[model samples]
Target: MCQLLGLNCATPTDASFSFTGFCQRGGATDHHADGWGIAFFEGRGLRLFVDHQCAAESRMAEFLRSYPLKSRNIIAHVRKATIGDVRLENAHPFSRELWGRHWVFAHNGDLKDYQPRLHSQFQPVGTTDSERAFCWLMQELAKSHAGLPSVEELTLTLRELLPQVRRFGSINFLLSNGDALWAHCSTKLHYLVRQHPFTQATLMDQDWTVNFAELNQPGDRAAVIVTTPLTRNEQWTAFEPDELKVFVDGLPVEVA
Candidate 1:
């Protein structure tokens, strides 16, 4: 199994705080240390980093913890390598281009004997089931619409397609395209939204705290999703089993 983390914001925001705490689970506080990767979406471009080393000890992860790269959408994963080899290419948070927009995906669970036919343009570069699933999702989306569809429309399509894959195994995942974040949960997932009248929050996995009121403006808002609660002080809502939700502008939007 693995761990997932996602951030969506109304304004460009740095995920260093959340990422630092999440990285601890890679080896220090937890044991999903086979590999780790992250993707940040800046406008239409994407900055991706992957490493085969444990995130808790990787020099690259340490640099990322210090570097404040701001993005409206971000997805990260710490892997335990159930379905793939422990290599850079097999890391989660895989990226691809769809309708000329860069899309990022990360999975937290494994699939058994799950190999979907990928005859379209999208293909996996690695042997991970997670990558294969991502390519297949992109391939199907490309076929369903001539171009990028509305968030609502995309949600409908995903709701229809995801169950087919989930039948094979757990399919908890996070996906984003710099516009909105789509999260699907088969077992465990939680989310929190930080907005006006922000309060102080403490990390669950580390001895760290942050006062949102002091660091953010009144208009600033952010939505965070993870496989488990990341903060000890914040109220995190657990997603219902087999639930799919879409987040836009730092808030959950009804996509029916």
Candidate 2:
């Protein structure tokens, strides 16, 4: 299994605080040490990074610990290889183009005998089941919708497709285009929203603290979703076993 991290914000925001804790699970606090990757959406472009080394030991992850690459939507993953070898190409947080927009995906669980036919346009470069699932998803989305479909329609399609995906194994994941972020939970997922009147928070996995009131503006709003709670003080809400959520502009929106 792997760990997932996501961010959706009203304004461009950095993920150093949450990422610090998330990185700890890569090899320090937990055992998901196969590989790790992250993607940050910047307008129409994306900043993507991946490494096959353990995030806790990788210098790349250390750089991300302090780097404040701001973005409106972000997806990250720390992998523990279950279906693929420990290689750079096997890392999570894979990306591809869809409907003229870049879409990023990361998986936290394994699938058993879950191969699906894929078109040549979106074939996976990696052998991991996570990447295969991502390609399948993009393939279906492309075949079903010529371009970006309505949010409701996308959600409905996702809800219908999720059950078939679950037949393989746990399918918790984070997905995003530049505009919005989507999260699906099969076992564990938690999230917190920070907005105006935000309070001080402390990381559960690291000895760090942040007073949101001092750094955030009155209009700033952010939603962070993770496989586990990232902070010790904030009241993180846990998603149900089979729940799916969509975040738009750093806020959770209705899902059918």
Candidate 3:
């Protein structure tokens, strides 16, 4: 299995603090060390970085930890290489263009004997089941809507489409289109929101703490979603099995 991390904020915010602790799981702390990648959405443009090297030792991951790149939406993945070879193309947080917007996706679980008929525009460049599933979702979305649908509409389509994929195996994943982030739980996942009157939090994988209240303003809000709780002290809510939720402006919004 792989590890997933996502951030959605009311305003542009840097992920350096969370990422620093997350990168350690790629090799130093846990054993998901095949490869890792991340994507940050800035307006319509995306900053994507992928490497075949382990995140804990990769220079690119270290650079990201030092650089405070601000983004409204971000997705990251650390691969453990269950289905594909350790290569750059297998690195996750994969991106593709759809309806004039960039869509990013990352998966944390493995699927067995899962292969969908992708007879459309969207196609996978990697051999991993995660990428294949992403392409199939994109293909289906494109077929269901003439243009980019609203977040609510997209959520509905995803909810309808995901069951077919989940039948194969665990399909925990994160998806974003710069507007909102959608997270689905087939096995394990957790999330938490940080808002006004923030407090100090310590990382579970690393001996690092950050006082978010010292840096953030009253209006700032952020929602972090991960495969597991990143901070030891913060209260994280676990997602129910087969649950799919959407986050906008740092809060979960109901859609059907």
lDDT of 3 by residue, 1-256 (tens): 9999999999999999899889999999999899999999998899999998999999999999999999989999999999989989999989999999999999988899888999998888989999999999999999999999999999999999999999889999999999999999999999999998899999998899999999899999999999999999999999999999999999999987
lDDT of each: 0.94, 0.91, 0.95
Off by over 4 Å in 1: none
Q: Write model 2 residue lDDT over 1-256, tens digit each, in one string.
A: 9999999999999898888899999999999999999999999899999999999999999998888899999999999899989999999789998888899999988799989788658898989888888888888888788789877778777887788789899899999988889999999999989999989999988999999999999989999999999998999999999898999888999964
lDDT of 1 by residue, 55-174 (tens): 999999999999999998999999998998998899989999888999999998878999999999998999999998999999999999999999999999999999889988999999
Regions more than 4 Å wrong, model 3: none
Query: What pairs collide in candidate 3?
Result: none
Clashes of each: 0, 0, 0
Question: For candidate 3, what is the TM-score?
Answer: 0.99
The alpha-carbon lDDT assigned to residue 8 of candidate 1 equals 92
Residue 104 accuracy (lDDT) in model 2:
96
The per-residue C-alpha lDDT of model 2 at residue 249 equals: 88
Q: What is the lDDT of candidate 3?
A: 0.95
